[model samples]
Target chain A: MENNRGNKYSIRQRILSSKLTFTILSIIMGLLVGAIVLLIAGFNPVQAYRIMIDGVFSRTKYISYAIIYATPLIITGLSVTFAFRTGLFNIGAEGQYIIGALVATLIGYFLELPLVIHVIVVFLFAAIAAGLWGGIAGFLKAKFGVHEVIATIMLNWIALYLNNYLVMRPFLRRPESESSYDILDSASITILEKWKYSETGREWLSAHPYIKDFLSAPANLGFIIAILLAILVWYILNRTTLGYELRAVGFNKDAAEYGGIKVEKSIITSMMIAGALAGSAGALQVMGVTKNVIMLPVMEGYGFDGIAVALIGGTTAIGNIFSGLLFGALQYGGPKIQPPLGAPSEVVDIMIGTIVLFIAIPKLFKIIMNARKRGEKNAK
Target chain B: MLNDIGFIIGTSLMYAAPLLFTALGGVISENSGVVNIGLEGMMTIGAFIGAAVGYYVGNPWIAFIAAGLAGGIFALLHAIASVTFHADQVVSGIAINFLGPGVALFISRLLFNGSTMTKSLSFSAKMPRPLNGLFRSNSFSDIIFNQYATVYLAFILVFVMWYTLYKTKLGLRIRAVGEHPASADTLGVSVTKIRYFGVILSGILAGFGGAAMSIAVVSNFRPTLISGQGFIALAAVIFGKWKPQGAMWACLLFGAAQGLTVYLGGAGVINISSQLLAMLPYVLTLVVLVGFVGKSVAPAASGEAYEKGE
Candidate 1:
């Protein structure tokens, strides 16, 4: 009996110290907090959650929408994770994203090229534009010792207003519309879009309604590209010499400098790569989803949401994919609760906020574990 | 021309008040070794609560105080996570940002019958202008002096903050704690207590900043109303090199830029796009940071979690 109790305590100790256990505990705590808030607001928490889950999973169409939502989030999360690994915070991802979309939209609308080549051209230009946009902050930090947070924050506002200005220009704006003109057919990345909507294809798909329903949404190559990029990012971080230098700089700039790593070069390179990743996300979003840049009165928050995704994912590439999907599902399905349970959709935000808050305090888990150990000792 | 200059000064002061309050908060918290980047979030909650209370209670003073209390409550959460639990200050601050708007919108929807915005307050319910009738309408003095009471309070607070931070024994202790908490701890000062006081006080001032916006500048609470103002204030804190008086000047410069944008766009004095005009302040901030202020160092112990007896 003594041996068994000792084994149980050790197991509990190991579980409490593990990262995965911490994440799970944070999530559960978030949900519990959400439920308490719901109860106070006079809503049934269980019913609200049920509605949310059903909304996301009840139909193939809804699942596609969730994946669609997750695509940009996953890519941007990877962007943030990459910067974080290099000891930099790329808060300028939003600006880079805007620049990417702006460049892609301009190229897609103006250029006349063949199918694959046009898409490649658009993406390349977009990446370059956004890479430069992000590189500006990196350059400022490396050269002048200005903090990246302030630089990036300032850059974000510039990008926002610049996007609006460009979109409102006579050449860019669609006739009688608030948004820019849509991309050419060759620039689109929607999966089998032509065939999916053609008369004969629709007739054939009628027999397979599930596939048809899934494609009915703007299901595109973005998610697949995002997954592939995640794998690529993971490989780069784990397997490459460049990744080594960047991680070294991240760990300790002084140590890395002593070890002959050019810290300034690493900072700039890391930011550029991170920017390209975020830029690609914006390009893909334009090619596959919106197809044009629309003027925004406020930020769309894709980049801000990326920060949450990166933090929740433990800053791992693989971890980001799962967290991105979770966030996507919550965001996509949050409104379902509003329609039926009469609970505000903002409850999802509260839940995510609470999760992040809990995750910020890993010491809380340690305190809990210590208390448990003391309680067991007392009982003996 | 005189009226235009008066309008410019008046508008600049109006815009500067909110940033001044929040930047002062940032100055205090950071001076005490706690980096309160969550000032934006605190301001957001304060804005919502201020507007909601002003509309419902029909008293601007009560609404302003309520807003500060709401901000203080959120700041306490930040203090707990970053101080007591030894969490990363930046991460905790980010969480506060998320929680602030989340709670604000949730409660707003609940209270306002599913609307995300609080009802607009009446002019009588809005912040009072103590100097309104002291000068003729549209005169230079009227434009410069006849402002909301919050504006006056914000300026006075700056002086008070500067005096407290520089002249008092408590101020010396707070500065010592920020510069080197270990040394201060050795000297018998309580690092934790000072940090808690700094963080919570910062939150209260940030709350007042939010109320300044909601009750004095704007009359209603909406999602976008307080957007980016907190961040701009943050930049002011950095621009001012973490000094209260310095931050005040930085905020005034940014505010003047804003005033210029509004004036140029509304008056059509320049044919530039409004979007382009709106970008001026942000661009100017970057230029000034790069060209004039090459390096602005933070407090020595800022953002570091202190372990007692370590």
Candidate 2:
């Protein structure tokens, strides 16, 4: 028996074995596939990609726009990542998100308080509502052995319809508009908006003579909050006892149960936490971006897209922030690509799908490595 | 009242047909020990292909086959990822779901000149109802008998799947492999092959379900056409307790819920908005899933990768 412990491998060898190698390779392959699709569709791939990149970073304001789009995505990524680590496939994040948004919109309109307290109240109620929404599925899984995937999906539809109903009612409804009425000024959170110094939109530009270049992008307090939450989630998962127990239950429920960990309780808690993160995402979206509710033809696919973000990030806390940003850039740039390139913006969707497909098959790297080893053995 | 009930039953059967095909596919795949959440993706693909083909060829039957074949091809990707690469089934399924809509939408833009929808086919091109002439005078008979051909076919597939699963040799092998792969392998069954068959069949069924939506029900392909029907079908599989006949009953019940919503809302019998009414089926699915209707057990190795000589 040869002991391989403490054996130093070359940097190249280590890099080849590292999990990030596969992720990077998958990303490259995904981009290449997307480029190929673009080329096939009669567009110059280089030009299209260049345009996308340039558009996402075109101005000081554009960068903020990207971050604004990223806010919900990062939160949703954390939501999905947390559930994944806890061994639950929470396909119901979409439902949780909408419920959170609904609660936030309701509270934002009804609650009359100072700005900070109102925002806090809206978020708190949103999280509680969405947490309970997600908890129902968890409870079902724990008690009745119901599959969470099925339960969550069903809940998503229910949430969508419920939101539609809520948005149409008198209290929330805006006269002569499909969307709900705007939240009170106290409930809104906008950093750049305040900097612009106008009562509304670009009006502040004239009043704030020195702020001509002030980038009044949709970027707001939500993006900052999302980034902080990601770091906090990483710390909790890596350092906390609750996370350790949750991970143990995720790894093997029977074994964890046998080890005296309350597996069922962990499941409920993990789902609730995941739900809270997603709920906050929706709440933030309403408070930071829309400030009002609109009737949606479909549940915004943010929750489903969160799955891609979590998967591409390898389900790490820090990785989620980067991946969320990457996706946000793509989304911000997507509309720009179509007008100039004749490419459907949906190509981004295809690229994301292909990337996830490649990542899902990590054994592909193993097979390649084994083949190379076999070749070396033959040469020897 | 009787006419309204007939309308509800008719709509319910139409709605249930798609769920039936998808749920049967789910049962077949899960029975063979592969969990497929990609049914939604597969159905999306099938619906798009079915609609595009039907629009071009003007033949509903040809469109249906093309859809099923397209579905089978897509499912093969899942098989390669989950079976050959030993990836997580859920991950592979999710990837497929993503790909399905992306690919469909991309191709639609290419073929249909940037529209997210396919060219609509004439109502005459839809699946024929053979009993329409005979049942012209009777609402009950018309509703039950004079429906899309796929509606009849879906009910028929329930018996077909039930017999195949419980009575056929292939079904036994699939069940054995799904339940205890190592033991099945010892008995000389190729677990991989059986699982592949099961997943592929699921794709085909789900694909046909997609075709049922576009060709029989809607007659056009929209990105939102498949929506969450695939997930509802999944719930049907669980509610039915992984049994084909049980799945049919569950699908019908869910479909009936959808149909009732339509009837009540359309007839102004219910003062609630249609959006709120739409919540009935999904809420029912949640309630049914939560309530212990019976002992619903999934196949033992449904989501695990089987490794030889592990």
TM-score of chain A of 1: 0.96
Clashing pairs in 1: none
> TM-scores of the first chain across all predictions?
0.96, 0.93
Position B308, candidate 2: lDDT = 97
The sequence of per-residue lDDT tens digits that candidate 1 reaches over residues A1-380 is 78877674567667779887888798898899999999999999999988989999999999999999999899889999999999998877888888889899999999999999999999999988888888988998898877888888888889999999999999999878779999999999998889988999999999999999899989999999899989998988889999999999999999999999999999998888888888888999999999999998888888878888888888899988999998999899988898777689988888998998998999999899889889999999
Off by over 4 Å in 2: A1-5, A194-214, B293-296
Is model 2 an incorrect, acceptable, medium or high docking prediction? medium
lDDT of 1 by residue, B76-145 (tens): 9999999899898888887888888889999999999898999999988899999988998888999999
**Candidate 2 lDDT over residue span B112-210, tens digit each:** 988999999977667777677887676676876688889989999999999999999998999998899999999999999999999999999999999
Q: Give residue A253's error in model 1 in angstroms.
A: 0.7
**lDDT: worst 10-residue window of model 1 chain B:** B288-297
Flag clash pairs in model 2.
Answer: A198-A204
